[model samples]
Target: MAIDDLLDEHEQSERVRNWLKNNGAGLIGGIALGLALIFGWKWWVQHRDQQAQAGYAAYAEAVKAIGGDDLKQAQAKVAALREASPQSLYAQLAVLELAQAQVKAKQLDAALATLKQVAADSPMKPYADLHAARLLNAAGKPEDAVKLLSSYDSPSALEVRGDALVQAGKLEEARDTYLKAMTGMDVASPQRRIVAIKLTHAGGTPPGSAESI
Candidate 1:
């Protein structure tokens, strides 16, 4: 190679070296930050998974606490689930289970209170309303039951509402309500047969029938 060519090649190498020396710390710092972000995201995902697992375990404890002679323990564990993570799906499910236990134990007031605590916008609202309406009817507050269940479209809720209307002696209304309930039920539901009988009873002479006027 020519001497000038060799000198020019060496100068180009020196320029690259100078550039690396000037920006090396910045490049290294950028790489380190990128690695930190990757690991930080993984750590957050693992932490969240662990928290959800723990929450699910706590929810199971609450459910097991029910269906035994340990009403107080059941209540405590369910309340703990809510306090630990009120926004969790498990917490909402726990509340619904707790209310059912309270109802089976015939603690009507406590059951109503538990169902009332469920937020209207929660995913469990329909279930809560159904349980509350039934409890109200059981407690001889059929009017309140009917009103609470008025906005719900569940087949079971409709049946309960029909029963409530029957108890209130609104026979015509009860017959129509029973019709609505039957439409929601599968033909195979045992409740369907029961509702059919109820419809027959509610479908006595119409108000404008000759027997009436």
Candidate 2:
């Protein structure tokens, strides 16, 4: 190389060394932080997946025990799952199953208490409330059932509320609730037909029915 070219190359090398000397610690720290974040994310994902798997396994055991008529074992498995992973979907399902088993055993009060264990913020909470309302209605607490379902406006909720109203001797409100329940249901839906029967029994005419004409 010519002298000028060699001098230029040496200047560039010196500049690079100076830059490194000034920023090397920061550069190393940035790399370490990046690697730590990457590994930390991987660990979090793996831990989450393992917890899900464990919850699923525990739920399966609970279901198997329920199927085998071993209520004690089923209850134990469900308790373990709930204690270990209370917020998990599998834990919610297992608890629901336990409540169902309790209901089938004619332990209505126990079933209601079991249903209450479901998280209020869970997606399954509405279903749990519906079940609890039914139990209350069956236990001759129709007014309580109506109060329990007061905040819900879903079709199923409305229908259950109507039933509770009817039992509570609020036929007019029951009919109104049944009409609301049938609002979006297809004309040919079996559920609509059932609701229509309830409406008629409540001394109200079902809309679109011959009596309503």
Candidate 3:
């Protein structure tokens, strides 16, 4: 209400207007950048969610195609899913299905090729490797089968490895691998009997006290 107070307030208002004139653009730019970042992050999340949903939908279609009458069409769908979403576990599963379909159709070479690629790229290495190795043996490439199975450290793969080694003419090694497989297997497992039979084939005799099923 006083003259001095009014002058002081007017001066403060003027100072604020001057600062705004000089600095407003920078402040506005900074605010715009922050808003852009927030919206951009939201957009990215939404985009990823959409992509994941679409990938799942495609995978489902591929799976359904497997049950249909057209085996080749199903294989194509699965292959497409793998190409579109190679990093996805669903895609890896599709690759497995496609390879098996190829196998049933007597497309052994193509099936092996698909399995090999899946083994190289998939996170499910153990299953993929096993499938590939078995098919390699069936394709009469037992040396390659043994080589591929060697990558697996899991006890379950030892049985397949032993079989492959046997076919590869490594009788002693096959017997040893089968013995190791037996150690890892449950006593009552039917797999134990199969391995035992393989061990017998390698050398008409079980190692030490091990019994053949």
Candidate 4:
């Protein structure tokens, strides 16, 4: 071939070789890092799924123990599940079950303490607070129940607050709260009838009742 063409080809080959030599280590490192990340993520997902399965097994056992009225065994299984998988959904459910079992056993203080362990950000927190408020009311601490439910505006929460207010002799406020609760509740709800009775008992007329009309 021509000398000029041969010289040009030789120069292009040298340039390609030089570029590879300069960037080879970085390219290899990038590939290695990509592979490590892919494998690491897969391993982490597998480990998480395995942990969830184990937690579910433990939670099921705890529930079975609770149903069988073996409180001690249920408590032990729940504690173990909590210790082993504190952040798991199954652990949270197990704690709620344990609290219910405690409440059924008339261990009010223990139930409250168990409910208190529910994380504030957990979806279960509102239910836990509801149970605690009921327990407080049952224990004749209506003021504490009112205070505990003060942050919530749900119909159920408002109903509980109204009950507490009635117990505390704040009849006017109780009537107002019951009215609000009824307004928020579904018209067809069975609980709405109960709340209406409470409102009338507190000297308030329900919105659609003949007396209110």
Candidate 5:
């Protein structure tokens, strides 16, 4: 009976040792996994920041090239940044800049196309729409310009719409639109002068300008 008791005690000790060994391994594995997750998250964040920085740097270089009046080189750099990070803010801004450069180079069709794409997009839709409307107005499509500007509720859109209405011989509507724009205009804002001019041309007196009704 004593021997049997001794054997039983020995078995219990072995079981306890095995259990301790297994638990120790599990604990070590859990700690290692936690560390790996932390490190992995940090590395991912660093990588994302690096990508963003590189995209922004490329955009800056493109801007510098533009300042040097090297439109072709600037376009190439913008293309590369766009390809590298199509969803980045820098990429979107680069596209807008490239479109403007195209306009400066008198590549109006390309500019219009790019601006149209941006206009239809959800992220930059307002800006793109405004630019597209401006270009359209410059291209002598005042009615289309008005339609495009009407899509946005911004003060600039109101001013643009007023200009389009005036150009289209809708003087009464133009006067009303100009008044809405004038509500937020300061003296330094070109809209102030613009609204006053339209009002005078529409046979109305400008509030701050020395002009006849």
Candidate 6:
């Protein structure tokens, strides 16, 4: 019985030692992995900030050049920034600004081209498309403008497209489009009356026979 008791105690000691030995490796590994994750996150954040700062700097230089009426210089700087950091906010804004500068220079074709490129490249394609629609309208391509505006989700574009249709002499279509605009807005009485006149010319009856817009 004495020998049996000694063996049982030795077995208990061995079991405890084994448990500690196995669990020690796991505990140390878990701590190391947690520290690595924390440091990795910090490094990633710092890198992203550095890239953003660089992109903004390039964009600012472009804007300054544009303000100085040096459009060629501005275009060069913006192109470089966009090429280097296509996904940056500054890159997107730079393109939009470049298009505006081109418009001011009476470079309508250039502006339209730049806006189209931005529309294809940027995440804010709808905004670029809106500007492109305006450019098309100003360029005397009302049909093209109407088509592009029709593709947008914004209701204001509907009004714009309706105006284009009216100018293009598609009176029936324009009337339909204008009524679609009045569907959601609080049209003033005077505007409603104007719409009624337009509708009558377009071979349609106005709401309430003389309703305001």
Highest lDDT among the candidates is held by which one? 2
Q: For residues 6-107, could you state the per-residue lDDT of candidate 6 as single tens digits?
A: 677779889889998989899889999999999999999999999878877888898898777778888888889878977777888888988988998999
Q: Stretches of candidate 2 above 4 Å error?
A: 1-7, 210-213
Q: Is candidate 1 or candidate 4 better by TM-score?
A: 4
Mind giving the per-residue lDDT tens digits that candidate 4 earns over 1-213? 776576777798898899999999999999999999999999999998897788788888888987877787887888888788776778788889899989889999988888887878778889989989999989899999999999999999999999999999999999999989988988879889899988888888888853342
Better of 1 and 5 by lDDT: 1
lDDT of 6: 0.77
TM-scores, one per candidate: 0.74, 0.91, 0.73, 0.86, 0.70, 0.79
lDDT of 1 by residue, 1-213 (tens): 776576777798898899999999999999999999999999999999999999999999999997678989998998899899888889888888888888888898998998887866788888888888888888899899999988877778888999899988888888888878878877767777778877777874322232221
| Worst lDDT 10-window in candidate 3 | 204-213
Best by TM-score: 2
- Candidate 3 Cα outliers beyond 4 Å, as residue runs: 1-45, 119-121, 204-213
Clash list (residue pairs), candidate 4: none
Which residue pairs collide, candidate 2?
none
The residue ranges of model 5 lying beyond 4 angstroms of the native Cα positions read 1-33, 68-73, 117-124, 186-190, 203-213
Better of 3 and 5 by TM-score: 3
lDDT of 2 at 65: 86
Question: Which pairs clash in model 6?
Answer: 191-213, 192-212, 192-213, 193-212, 193-213
**What range of 10 consecutive residues in model 2 has the weakest lDDT sum?**
204-213
Measured over all alpha carbons after superposition, the RMSD of each candidate to the real structure, in angstroms, is 6.5, 3.1, 5.3, 3.5, 6.6, 4.8
Winner on lDDT (2 vs 4): 2
What range of 10 consecutive residues in model 5 has the weakest lDDT sum?
A: 204-213
Each prediction's total of clashing residue pairs, residues at least 3 apart in sequence or on different chains, is 0, 0, 0, 0, 0, 5
Q: How many clashing residue pairs, candidate 5?
A: 0
- Count clashing residue pairs in model 3: 0
Model 2 agreement with the true structure over 14-119: per-residue lDDT tens digits = 9899999999999999999999999999999999999878878888988998777777778888888889989889889988989999898998998898899999
lDDT per residue (tens digit) for residues 1-213 in model 3 = 766576777798898999999999999999999999999999999999999899989989998997677877987898788788777888888888877877788888888877766746567767978888888888789898888877675667898888888888989999888888888877878878777888898884654464743
